[model samples]
Target chain A: MRRILSSVTDGRGFDILLVSITMIFLLALSGMPLVYNVVMSFQEVDMFNLNTFSRPYAGLENYREVVSQPEFGLILKNTAFFVFGSIAGQFVLGFALAMFFMMRFPFAATIRGVFLVSWVMPGLVVGALWGWILAGDFGVLNAILKGIGVIDSTMFWKSDPRLSIWAVTIANIWLGLAFNMMLLSVGLAAIPRDLYEAAELDGANGWHRFTTMTLPMMRSTIGAVLALGLIYTLQQFDLFPAITEGGPANSSNVAQYWAWQYSFLLFDFAKGATVSVMMLGFVLIASIVYVWSTRHEVRG
Target chain B: MTPQIEIASVDKHYGAYHALKDINLTIPRGAFTALVGPSGCGKSTLLRSIAGLESITSGNLRIAGTEMSGVPPRKRDVAMVFQSYALYPHMNVLGNLTYSLRFKGFNKEQARKKADEVAQVIGLTELLERYPRELSGGQRQRVAMGRAIICEPKAFLFDEPLSNLDAALRVHMRMEIRALHDRLGATSVYVTHDQVEAMTMADHVVVMRAGVIEQQGAPLELYDNPANKFVAGFIGSPAMNFLDATVAEDGRSARLEIAGKPVLPLARTLQPGREVTVGLRPEHLRIDTAAPRLQVPVRVVESTGSLTYSTTETEPELMIVEQGRGRYRAGETLPLTIAPEDIHLFDPTSGTAL
Candidate 1:
């Protein structure tokens, strides 16, 4: 006992003790739930069986039922569109803003810091704010577009099936932009200034320098940002309820919101767990990419 | 010879602080000029301005007799070797060497051929496929030089390119760079804080202090006849010793303010009873027991195998360097003599040579 106590207080034993504590906490909180969810997807999980860990096995039935649903293909397509659209919008705009703020002007850093407000605000709150802005008739976006002569009629963002998914995607893009910019700014700042100067003296023009120096130096950072963006966009659910509620004939219903609808509204725990387990595969790939890119940082 | 680079009345201001003030310099074609000073003396700033990496606030800059004011660095046709080497980390050795060729619209085959020739010239033939991080410091430095020379730009700018290397490698690279310059007959401007590098590597050395050129001339000329007290102190290692003195009423001899107040004859006449600063190089001061000289107690005696250096016990200590091993010990009194012609006189207040 004394040896264990002393080891916990000093030496490599202490390091192992701390690591094992974290490992145990992660296993109990994250690992156990993931395994349980996967197990629930393979079992007949009704209300009576939900309270118990031991349930009758029904392998692949939940997956087959979930896949055969009329809305399954629509939800999968919406999820793909949401993930790719939100990521593309967030990354390009965020990178441009990061580069803009990198210029040595007064209040550049302070202004860039102010941009973190979007990232810091609760996603539900941002969704609520964007909900009003994206309203069809009285929203600020329609008003601005009307004022700019880009549109003469109301474009129903939430009610119309075609625009409802786009409304949530736009809101999610705004929500994720600040995060992408901050991470990319860190990557940009890591590049030594002398490299640019040397490239300039090497007879590279502005566009050439961007292609040769800035882009190449930011490879790992770009990879991490994109991978994280994919994971974050896939996890997004608050914006859908606030803006579109995945409704208007379920045109905006993505996999995450559909999973919630299955478990809570319809009480189909098996189908919900099955959908979430499928999402785990995508998130797993994204996490691997994030880790690999971050590990491959090319610093001198 | 026509000047390769010419600057007239150049000034640089960073908001309220003046960096380079009213600078004028001319680099003759094929001559290697060194801009050398202590840190923050604008040597690097001047080199950057020459490379068009920095813009002069208000000055006329001409490269090869063409005005370069308001021209971008890409259009300036000059190459620079930065102190950090700045070899593109993502690119291999050949890629780094061929990067500029791509901007010149060279095809892949031509670019690779040029890279091959330059790699051989810099002795990086075997390492063409390796990245910059894989190379050693000396190898990276050679790659930087090769990158600069591959384009055959009109002028080359080096911003303390060898300061990062080990001492032995620095010496080796120094000769390699000089030999490369001679082989190319390229107009080069090198910036360094080390006066030894300036003296040995450059035909013309420009000494700067506080945003102004203190003196610029041939290396031996600056050493033999420094224009000011700062240049004299800065040009030599184990810097020149300065002593307070007052010229005698005869104007031909000066009384040094040491323990005994020894009187030493001057090589040139100066205003009688004027206060002056006596500048004496350590190498110029010698040990002579038979001559009339100042006797002072030795404080420390340090010797390398071929040379010896000793300091005298004075209010402001005096140092002397002699060839061969020193025979003096601490606490021993030794008589030191310097040739009258070797003594440099400066106005005490202005630090300007008289």
Candidate 2:
């Protein structure tokens, strides 16, 4: 007993003790739910035996049913649009802002710090805030666009089928922009200032320096940022409920919102788990990319 | 031939701080000039201004007879080897060497061939595919030099490039850099705070202090005939020993304020009874017990196998460096003498050579 106690206090046993605690937490909450969901997807999970783990085996039936839904094709397209659209918009704007703040001007750090307000805000709150800005009639965005003569008629963002998915994507871009900028700014700051000076003396102008030095140095950071952004964009759910609620006849329904709709709104637990399992594959790929890109993070 | 670079009446200011003051310099073609001073003395600032990295507040700059005022660093076409080496961490050695050629419109194959030639010259042919993080410090320094020489710009600027290496490597690289400059016949402007480095490497040395050019001339000219007391004190190692003195009534001899007011004969005539400061080089002072000049007790002795450096116990201590092992012990009075021409005199108030 004393040997065990002493080992736990200050030895390899202490390391094992700390690791097992985190393992138990992860297994009980995350591992168990994932296994149960995967198992439930392969079984007949109807309202009759909803509370039981054992059920009549229905291998591939739920998968086929989920894939055969009439809205499957549209949801798949909308999810693709939302994911790629949000990632592109956020990354471009975020990288631009990161470079802008790197200039030597007064209040650069203070203003960059204020950009974190968008990051700290809850997703639902940001969605509501963007909802008002993207509203059909009194929205500031539409007013400005009309004022600039880009449009004569109002852009009915959340209500129209063509713009419903786009509304959530725009909100997500605003919500994710600050986080992307912060990570990119850290990467930019990690680059030595002398590199730019040396390049300039080596007969390189601004654009050449950027293409040759800045972009190549930022490769790993950009990879990690894009991968994390993909995983985060796929898991986005609060913006959907707060803005369009995946409405306009399921025009803006992404895979995550569609999975929620399957299990809760329609009470089809099997289809819900099957839809989420498909997303898990994508998230797993993104996780692998994030890990791989960070392999060079410990460089001198 | 016209000078390679000329700065006439240049000045630089950072808000209220005047960094370079009324600087004027001329770099002849193929001359290796060294700008040397203590830290924050504007030597590096002047080097950067010549490279167009920092703009001068008011003055004209010329590079190879072309007016360089308001010109950017890239347009100036002068490459610099930074002290940090600043190799691109992501690129291999060959990529770093060829980056400038690519921007200058060289095709990939042509640039690669040029890189191979330069890499062979710099002895980096074996390390072509190694990233900067994989190379040793000396190899990285060689790559920086290779990058600078590949462009074949108008001139080369080196900002204390060997300061990061260990002592043995620093000495070795110093000779290597000088040899490279000679072989290329490049007009190179080097900056350092070490007076020994400036004296040993540069044919023309410019000494600066507090943003002003204290002196500029050939290394031996500055050493043999320093323009002022600051130059006199700065140009030599174990630094020139200074002592308070006044010219005697005869005007050809001065009384040094060591012990007993010993008289030191002057090389030239001066105003009688004029108060002045005497400068003496350490190596010039010898133990002439046959004809003693000044006597002071020894305070400390340090030996580095070859030479002996000793200090004298005086109000303001005098440091003496002898050629071989010193036989004198501490706390013992030692008689020393210097040659008449080597006894440098300066006006007491102005610190200027008389």
RMSD of each: 1.2, 1.9
CA-RMSD of model 1? 1.2
In model 2, pairs of residues that clash are none
Candidate 1: interface RMSD in Å?
1.0
Q: lDDT of candidate 2?
A: 0.93
Q: By TM-score, who's the top model here?
A: 1
Candidate 2 lDDT over residue span A251-276, tens digit each: 99999999999999999999999999
Encode model 1's per-residue lDDT on B1-354: one tens digit a residue: 889999999999888889999999999999999999999999998888887878889988999999998888888999999999989998999999998888898999999999999988889999999999999999999999999999999999999999999999999999999999999999999999999999999999999988899999999999999999999999988899999999999999899998899988999898899999999899998899898478889999999969999998997999989999987888998888889999999989999999
The lDDT of each candidate is 0.92, 0.93
